[model samples]
Target: MRVLITGATGYVGQAVAVALAGAGHEVHALTRDPGSDRARALEDFGVRPLRGRLADRAELSGMLAGADAVVHTAFDPHDPVGADRALFGALADVGGRRHLVYTTGCSVYGEHAHAVLTPRTPVDGGNLRARLEAELRSAGLPHTVLRPGMVHGGDARSSIVGDWFREARSSGPVHRGRRDKVWSWIHVEDLARAYTAVLRAPEEHDGRAYLLADARPVAPLAVVEAAARAAGRTDALAFAPVEDEKPVYRVFDRDEVIDSSAARDALGWTPQESDVLAALPASFRQWSAART
Candidate 1:
């Protein structure tokens, strides 16, 4: 399969690109700077980097034309909804027969009281991610939505794990909401394998959404303490509460326990790194190396 990946330089997208390439797919990545070190690194790994912007419909259409499937992972943190609208419009216009593997996040299932979330779990229709997902479903494209949990490992600098390390180094481990609020987590590499499994048979995944996370649901403070331990700051593991004014923090206050059995059963996807705390030492090393 000829696969095109958006945000190929991003932490998650880069892993997915390499995983697809390793799976023997001809992989191309959409990057803003094809001449950068990251793009060069991807080229070394057999992923061709193409210069393009997600907001550019013509560029996106042209890039979309050459691939058998598109793994849409590009996100504009500044204007996420606007960027996705453009990408989805382009996909609707030119994405004939091409399978779109759209990446959404577990936060879309906002404030759910369910002990474990599945694909069949009702999503918060008012959440921005859920609204965009609804738009994708209405666009009439051949697509699958993947709602990944809090991703860690593999260049952990770009992930929430890095935030823990940085905070631990400065002031100690900080818990944003309640210390007991649990989150579903996945390693970047395992999440990449899930993408490979889905793209291997896109038809099998079309029109369906899957939550991608490890089987274990862990408290944020526990992970933070592990990160502190890995960073040799176990003595400074005292937790502090940061006042975050963002509305998203409210969602973070709730437990995001996810059941990825749907993905495991349907796509033969199994998460190898189920215990995030056990991997914090290596993850801390990766984060430190990324800083230097």
Candidate 2:
């Protein structure tokens, strides 16, 4: 199958492209800058790099011409509804019920305090997740939606959790919220595999949603501590809640859990990395090495 992956040079998109290409599928990697180092890196893994932005209708339509499926991961979170609708309209006019898979975050369930979240949970009205959800639904295609949890890994690049780990190394301590919130987490590789599984079996997942979280949730303090231990800064670590309103800390300042059993049962997807806490230290160490 020929699959066109938008944002193919991005963190998640690159991982997904690699997985699909490795599985013997032809991958069309759409990116804004074909001359970029990231785009060239995709070529190393046998991905066909194509230059196009999401806003370009002619380019997107031409790219979709020969694609058997499209995984739309390229999105502007603040203003995605317009682009999403345009893509959906184009696909509809193109005259094939091609499998369209859209990616959203698990935050749409929004602060799952007491109740566990599933695909069936009602979404919050006034959050980024809700707006994204509304856009996906309005697309009017039998699109498969994947809601991944706090995606970490990739050596502290483009990951909030990875950033925290790096910050702990440089700043001596990392801040967490006052609450002992347990966040659902997913490694970039694992999340990429989920996309591959869906692409392979799109017929079974049209108009369906899946949560791609690891089997367990980790505490914020635990992750910071892991990074500290990895850097051999056991004495240099101090954990405290953020008193001031820093934007990045807000996402980690909440509690949420996800039920990814639907994804597991439906797509035969099973996450191999069950020990996130154990893995965090090494990830941070590698990230530090890359910088210096």
Query: How far does residue 231 in candidate 1 sit from its true spot (Å)?
Result: 1.0
State the lDDT of candidate 2 residue by residue for 92-195, as single tens digits: 76768678888878667654454467888887766665775676567666678899887776665677666666676577766567557777888888888998
State which candidate has the highest lDDT: 1
Q: Which residue pairs show backbone clashes in model 1?
A: none
In angstroms, how far off is 135's CA in candidate 2? 3.7
Per residue, candidate 1 scores C-alpha lDDT tens digits across 76-187 of: 8988987888888887778488999999887787756777889888999998999999998898888999989899997785788988899877877766766778889999
User: How many angstroms is residue 275 displaced in model 2 relative to the true structure, after the best TM-score fit?
Assistant: 1.0
How does model 2 fare in lDDT?
Answer: 0.77
**RMSD, one per candidate, in order:** 1.4, 2.4
Summing lDDT over every window of 10 consecutive residues in candidate 1, give the lowest-scoring window: 234-243
Clashes of 1: 0
> Model 2 residue 96 lDDT?
82
Report the C-alpha displacement of residue 163, candidate 1, in angstroms.
0.4
